[model samples]
Target: MDPFEKMSLVGLRRYQAIVKAQLPIAFSHALEETTPWAEKALERLQKRENLVTEAIIKLEFGDDPDLGSQVSRSAAEE
Candidate 1:
């Protein structure tokens, strides 16, 4: 991979790890808030986390045409 791609993969991995680690804490806080907005925010975070995970998988395992489309869609949504 080119330097930029390598860096991007590293960054994505770091972000995925951070998000995975924080999810439980976030869930607890969201539950404590007990508001629709809090639930919505948590849901958004989970969606982003899934995208990052897919991106990481794509990078690590080489391209999958379907995953390429999925990643593109996720990026567009962002």
Candidate 2:
């Protein structure tokens, strides 16, 4: 992979870690605010894995020209 792809991957990995770490606290706060709403929101949010992944990928890779090209080529090869 190119440098940009590597960098973006690193960023994505870090972002995932941060999100994972914060999720429980976020859910707890949400629950404290309201149980039923929190549960429903969490359910809907959990179902958006693909969208979340794509958004992260796009945010990480879209701005860098090198990463963008690498991603495009990789997708084409697949």
Candidate 3:
């Protein structure tokens, strides 16, 4: 973004042939940088899925079974 902004300031704002040419390369680099972090987050969620589900169930059905059932029914309908 900083490089693109520099290019824009250096050249015409309305038409940036250089920026347009480099957009895909820049986007690819950005995705490459973040992909690992995203993958790790997804892996962590997958690993903890059962524990998270148990926590949610406990919270939902803690004190009121009727309310929990209503919520479950509404969510199912949706």
Candidate 4:
């Protein structure tokens, strides 16, 4: 076994290389083994992002909008 792997400490370059090398392998395996799970995760994330965008749009331009004014006031105070 490599000395770094045997111990808790690794050189910075070695650590970076290890991470860089493993990312593709990990992603490939994840894509192959967890297609449905990955798709569900992505869909959930997209739904969350859409909800956040809608909320932000409402805050910026709705009838009872207050966050924009609050942000501008805070910036002016600063």
lDDT of each: 0.74, 0.58, 0.46, 0.48
lDDT of 3 at 42: 48
Model 2 compared with the native: what TM-score? Answer: 0.40
- Which of the numbered candidates is closest to the native, going by highest lDDT? 1
**Runs off by more than 4 Å, candidate 1:** 1-7, 65-78
Q: After superposition, how far is residue 48 of candidate 3 from its true place, in Å?
A: 41
Q: Least lDDT summed over 10 consecutive residues: which range in candidate 3?
A: 1-10
Q: Which model, 2 or 3, shows the larger TM-score?
A: 2
Q: Compared with the true structure, what per-residue lDDT tens digits does model 2 show for residues 1-78?
A: 332234455676665565556567657867787777777766655544334455455665666767766765674365
Clashing pairs in 2: none
Q: Rank the candidates by TM-score, best first.
A: 1, 2, 4, 3
lDDT of 1 by residue, 38-76 (tens): 788788779878777666767865688886776667755
- Prediction 1 TM-score vs. true: 0.65
1 against 3, candidate with superior lDDT:
1
Candidate 4 lDDT over 5-53, as tens digits, reads: 3322234344434554554555565577788766565555444434433
**TM-scores of the candidates in the order shown:** 0.65, 0.40, 0.26, 0.38
Give the Cα error of residue 77 in candidate 1, in Å.
Answer: 26
Candidate 2 or 1, higher lDDT: 1
Worst 10 residues of 1 by lDDT: 1-10
- Candidate 4: segments with Cα more than 4 A from true spot: 1-34, 63-78
lDDT of 3 by residue, 1-78 (tens): 222223222243323333345545555655677777655654544434333332344454665777766765674465
Show where candidate 3 strays beyond 4 Å: 1-15, 35-78
